[model samples]
Target: MHHWRIDDARQTLVLAATGERLPQVVYWGPALPAQENLATLHATHAIDVTGGMLDANPDLSLCPEATRSFPGQPGLIVRDGEGTPLLPKFCYDSESNGNDLRLIYRDAANGLTLTFIFALDPDTHIITAQTVLDADAPVHLHWLAAPVLPAPQHSGEMIDFSGRWCGEFQTNRTAWSAGMRYRENRTGRTGHEHFPGLIIPCTGATNTQGEAYGFHYGWSGGHRMIAEELQDGRRQIQWGHAARMETEAATQFKTAPLYITYSPSGLNGCATAFQRHLRDRIITWPKPDAPRPVHYNCWEAIYFDHNVPALKDIATRAADLGAERFVLDDGWFGQRDDDTRSLSDWTVDPRKYPDGLHPLIDHVHGLGMTFGIWFEPEMINPDSDIHRAHPDWALGGEDQTLGRQQKALNMALPAVRDFLYDRMSAILREHPIDYIKWDHNRVLPMPDAAQTRGSYALIDRLRADFPQVEIESCASGGGRVDFGILQRTQRVWLSDSNDALERLRIQHNAALFLPLSVTGSHVGPRYCHTSGRMHDITFRAWVAAQRHMGFEMDPRELTDKEATVLRHVTAWWKANRDWMQRADILRLDSADPAVIAEQQLAADGARFVVFAGKADTSAQIAPRPLRLTALDPNAQYLISLANQQDIHHLSRGTPALKSGPVTLTGRYLMANGITLPWSFPDRMWVLEGKKL
Candidate 1:
């Protein structure tokens, strides 16, 4: 037997192989002692054979084989060029181990090679694993999973995400059983309906305490996830590109990186690891040292009605409201007056901008804010000039149903990517633009890995040519969000629905894997256009302030008092953004189910801010004391109610926090927690704390 182990500060994963068979992960959890013997541990990891079972259990190898009669879902499924299923039994060939581990296995009889690669980030505590398959001849791949990993037997339930357009990141909890909890997203993009993430809490794990494991399949292309509990009591998780995504036969197939982490300190531990890994390691920021600017997007404000003078006036007002980056959303190009036409034309609409975009961009610049424009390069309207010229360029059958009056451009074609790059590059070359709101408005007709790869290529090319230009991945908001898309973009439009009340829950839940630096949360109009629910300026602005702060509403609609409140919140966001950008968003466990609260704890652990949003009415009469996390119990902190002025006159009793700032130990604060003045539903409370 051969055994190997990979260790980081927080976790360790051990793999073992018998004879020349492929290796399997035998142990994965909290950091093990450095002097422990992996070989002895692997030997002890085996189970006894039962009456109804075979004499010995088949190894759940890196690529479990149907040839070996493995009872669980195999790690791979493939066929020859003629569509004949080939069940090759991969054998251990070679291995490489260091900070990263690479193991190769070969099936000489079938002329196939299977490889598993693993890399652990020491600081972020995230483990990245992937699988690659190479064949001597062309083959058809039905499914290719990333390096398969064992699921914790102690985990009672598994949490996966599923939701609709505005309602993204809704968690679905499934109890562990003797069968598979299978989920597949064939929407072509990382659909809002099925986010590629899973969290398994060991037994009684909560958001703040206990042990948990997190996994995210980082692919913008559609994906499939399997959480299977075999009859032998072994559990495994498999994540890969959606089955049959590769339409054509090929010699090689590869799975996207699967990020894994084990958290002994509960779900927040997993959250922080993913957050730091994405922000500090995965993303390539154009201006690393610059603060995340206050954003102002125009989609909700004006829709497709683009008048140059009106937009200029709006830009000025947005700047006055403390917006440092003005993003001109959709309908800026291709004679696009509405969503019905001019999608892939990719040229400035002469009707909308008589003098090109210079005057408006200049006005935005004059107001001391950078300019950004929108583009939907991967889509085409049937009536668009480009679509008219190249009808064959669109993907799927001609009679396929349309979304948003448009079809996805055939991104797999080189000509299509070239057309988008050329048109987008021309605009960037001419305009003094620093950002692009790269929007993918609709899902593809079918899931295709090549199409997703093609889209990545175009964005990669654009990023290379204009290294300074930032991109925001917006797929009708939250549809295309994942580490794969985030690799090429700087920000993400979290949701199209700018309803602050809706956003409070969305942002809170999304904090599991998203950081404030890339999550774009915008304050919408007083009367939300999507949900048609009106919210107070204080509540709206604070909700926006929770992440990458922005405003999507018409500044002209804000009353004098409303504008002042917005400006104050915007200023506060600006002041705290420097540290908040790198801060860890810790979701607090609210005793009241009605409240959604989170603490943005600074990276250095010196300060933090808590946003307690009362999403609905509480069952009890008074407000519950909200507890904080990741604090030094012995340290004293100076706590103050940041939005004490927003306290309504109906709140008669003066709570200690309502009157003035209080100095308290972290122990007392975390144990007894901080109680605030009573407030009605739809309101929010902001509390600031600093180490004293």
Candidate 2:
């Protein structure tokens, strides 16, 4: 028997080959002893398809199937040239290179070959799998998945997310059931409605208790994630790029890798694994150690009113409030006063800046802040010059549906990709622009593989040419949040909505899989333009400070008191952002449903910060004690309020701070917890703790 098992630091993946069939995962969970073999496990754990099977070995009961079964979705689907399903038998051969594993299977009838690639990050306990197909003869490919694995047992609760526009990354949980639960996004881009990941926690598991497993689809385009429980109590979770092909040459194609990890320590354990994998392997930060700049965007300030004098005034005021980057949003190019026209033109609007953006750029630089600009390079307005010149470049044709009055460019076309790359590259060469807020406001009407590949190619080309230019991925906000895009861009605008209260839930859920350093959080105006909710400036700033801090308000309208609060928040962020960047994030469980608590513990066990906010509190005067986590039990810590001044008039007898810089042992803090001040709705508090 030819079998293999790969062991990461915490888990083990066991694969076995039985005769001519492709190898299947027999076990994936907490590591077994080093001397354990797959034969013993398979004899005891493999599904028994003895006499009750129609196909002898029932396909539905198999661990991984090449085609769909009654129990779950197929991991691979392909058809032939004449529109017939190509169900081929497997011919297996295996090999290994370093720590990576490769298993080859051939279909002699269809002249096609499939290879399953597997690798594990020894440190993070992340298992990666990818599927590749090769064919010598003409074959029409339908759909191909990365890889699929089945759970040993069907006892757990499924956790996922759903949201829209300004309200993204809303968490949802459901008990494991027999029927299939599928979440899919066909919006061309990863829509804000659903995330491309799933978490399955063992029955009755808490944030830090029991066992949990995470499955993340690495593709950034349209995707499908499914969790199904079979009649026999076994569960299967599968994910892959959601692409359809009627009849195309199947010479070679590879599905994006799907990442899987198991955590005995529950949700927080899974989160830590994902964060480490992203920061260490996925995101390529320009300055990983340096703090992200506090940006002040001009979109809300003077939308489409792009004049040099007005922008200069805003920039000056933003700098006075410690904004290190000033971004000029939409309406700066070719007749782009509104969303209707001039998207792909990529030229500075002469009417807005007669001197070709130089005066505004210089003014921003003179204010000691980096200059940034916004662009929707992959979209074209029908009224713009680019569309007029290349009407056929639009995806789904010009006659199809339009979003935000704009159509997506056919990124798969070499001509279109080159055009976008050249035009965006030219802008970088022409000016001292330090950042690019790449926004994709529309979704693709059809799932064209070219669009995703092409968009990625264009961004890659631009980044390779201008290494200093930082890019933010904004697909109508939180629409393109994934490891694939994060690989090319520095940060993501978590959502378009700047309502602080809404942002708390959005940021909290997103931070589960993404590092706060790569999430773009902004302090919007007092009256949120999206939600129309008015929040205090201090409340807004405190929430934004938890991530890559920025501001999306007009500084010219700020009151003197508001300006002082903004300045203090920015100063405090600059002083503590280093710890926030590298800390291990932990979302604490609260007995009260109204309160959300999050903690960031420094890697060295020296410091940590906790952010507690309430959307709505009960009538009870005293809130439950907030237990802190991820601290060294032996060490002592000194605690203080991040915002010492009672900006919101917090109750005087708050348990978090009863005296000046109260000191407590980490063991006590983790076990006993602390109480928070009673305040009105939408109130937040930040507590900082330093090892003593």
Candidate 3:
């Protein structure tokens, strides 16, 4: 349970608790208010959020997040001398978040006391708790890695990038690094298993007089976050293990459907700022229990040029394998084969679908699956009818029209917005398209190719009018990804690159800013798109960790063994979905070749730790120290599992098990880890440590 209080100005809702505040997130703009001066928060896995107890937009007023604190407890009802206890503390050291609320419990229990600072729009705040349970109904005791830091305070209406932050010591753990040191694999592209996308950059060292200890990274939007080193060179990022839950916003007059505000402050202020911008940013799902689709796409198997029947065959096979959704890639749209013309058609190709998309969709639906189509609405081809119809709507001059793919559409015009709106809406309303893979293929072009107020205004307009539909923003991959789109779309296509190695980097890089829920990742078989570098099929499958997961391959192309493995893996993922969503992600590897591995567990002690030794595959017999402080100190559990070779060569190609808590002594776990008789196996392997 989470609680909050607003300040006297009723703007910032000071967060009281949120465990280990290292949550990487992105934001689009200020919240939209339906009524006046109230905000509403949301909880996932729940049925619905639309009810009588909510508002449209909350006030995203400026408040101190880093330099502030919210004083309160979940079950404690201590009131102000004369009134109710406000969530926002009168005095603040900096922006604060829900981390304080979480740490309160930890501190009370003698566990490590974690602290986080953040700012929210005066209107609303949201807290999401890890409600995942183990297969047996117990919570897996997962390890927490992200650290909490002060939310930057930029001089703006809404907090954005401040560029620099100070004030550490207050949280006072006094462990880890002493000064500030930047993390090498901030993007997590190392292709390691156990720690695929961990971006916990900066180690704390002693800082001497605040002499530049903070490091910065480029954000998709103009927004960015900073991790400053204090007088002691301790490197810390913004608020950690984000448990988002904020107050409900009151109704306000309607303006825009949703409005996202960018602070010169950067992305760190997003959640806190969300408090103010809650009302309109609220996207009520038509069906609360909308099962996140189990999907397979053609992009990986056949890129943009894949023919319709090939795609349909892929869809048919995918459906047979329990996939619920099928998405058609490019090439299917307009005269898109060579990217020369036909984009404006927005119509199905005659030769491809003969009977139009309805038939292809019918075929997919007939197989008891939902159909999805990909579209690049904000773009237009030079040879397109719409572009030729209104040449003035395009951004470039005579013949020099920027052609990232054919001629790009100039989205900066109201006419363009209307054109896209009418075309897209009509398609959705008329088709059996249950899902849409909305993509934005190219960057904004040398910056100013658009004739209107640049791309920002265009995006804003499209977002405002494009509704009742699911949209995804793709920048020829992950280039233009940001929170702005998240405010309007259901998910963002993470990247065009699908190679597992590339994904290991891309996903990690993207997760540094966006939440896992919105990052669409496909388990590509072998390897496709991103270099086509093939590793092992199972190794590729291992990359899926509940982030809107799916695949982009021809099911028919899978080997018998590969298919069996995929089926088992998918089943396991769904079974463990709770843990993946609710627990803290502890990524253990750096993408470097010499050393890389990944280990993630849920509440009760169940974890998936994979070690893809990159350096000397010289197997070590020394028991690896498996951290177990996240679990009960005295409770002993058993270890179960074996490497691929051990399973195949020794036990009829299945996991081996043993009884013991993998054996631990004192407060630390003994390293009796993998006793590999050989070097890192060239083949993919798995080791599930079952609790004894």
The candidate, 1 or 3, that scores higher on TM-score is 1
**Residue 456 displacement in candidate 3 (angstroms):** 7.7
Give the alpha-carbon lDDT of every model: 0.93, 0.81, 0.42
lDDT of 2 by residue, 1-692 (tens): 55788887688888776676777677888888988967888666656564554343433322256442344566666667666887666576556667688887877777878888888998877888888888776666556767767754745578898888888888888777787888878787878987888888877666766688887777778887778787666677767766472224657877777888888877887888888788778888766666788988898999987878888999999999999999989998898888899989988788888889888889999999999999988899999898899999988864688899989898889999888888888888999998999999988878766588888999898888898888999988899988888889988999999899999888888877888778889999998889878999888998998889999998888899999999999999999887778887788887778888888888787988999888786656777778888777898999887676753455656453745578888898889886666667787878899998
State the lDDT at 112 in candidate 3.
Answer: 21
lDDT of 3 by residue, 651-678 (tens): 2321123221254331333222343222
Q: Please list the residue runs of candidate 3 whose C-alpha ends up more than 4 Å from where it truly belongs after superposition.
A: 1-288, 304-308, 397-403, 446-468, 525-529, 589-595, 601-629, 642-667, 670-692
Candidate 2 least-lDDT 10 residues: 54-63
State every prediction's TM-score relative to the real structure.
Answer: 0.99, 0.96, 0.58
Ranking by lDDT: 1, 2, 3
Model 3 compared with the native: what TM-score? 0.58
Tell me the tens digit of each residue's lDDT in model 1 across 608-659: 9999999998999999899888899999999999998999999999789988
Model 1: pairs clashing at backbone N, Cα or C within 3 Å: none
Instruction: Return the TM-score for candidate 1, rounded to 2 decimals.
Output: 0.99
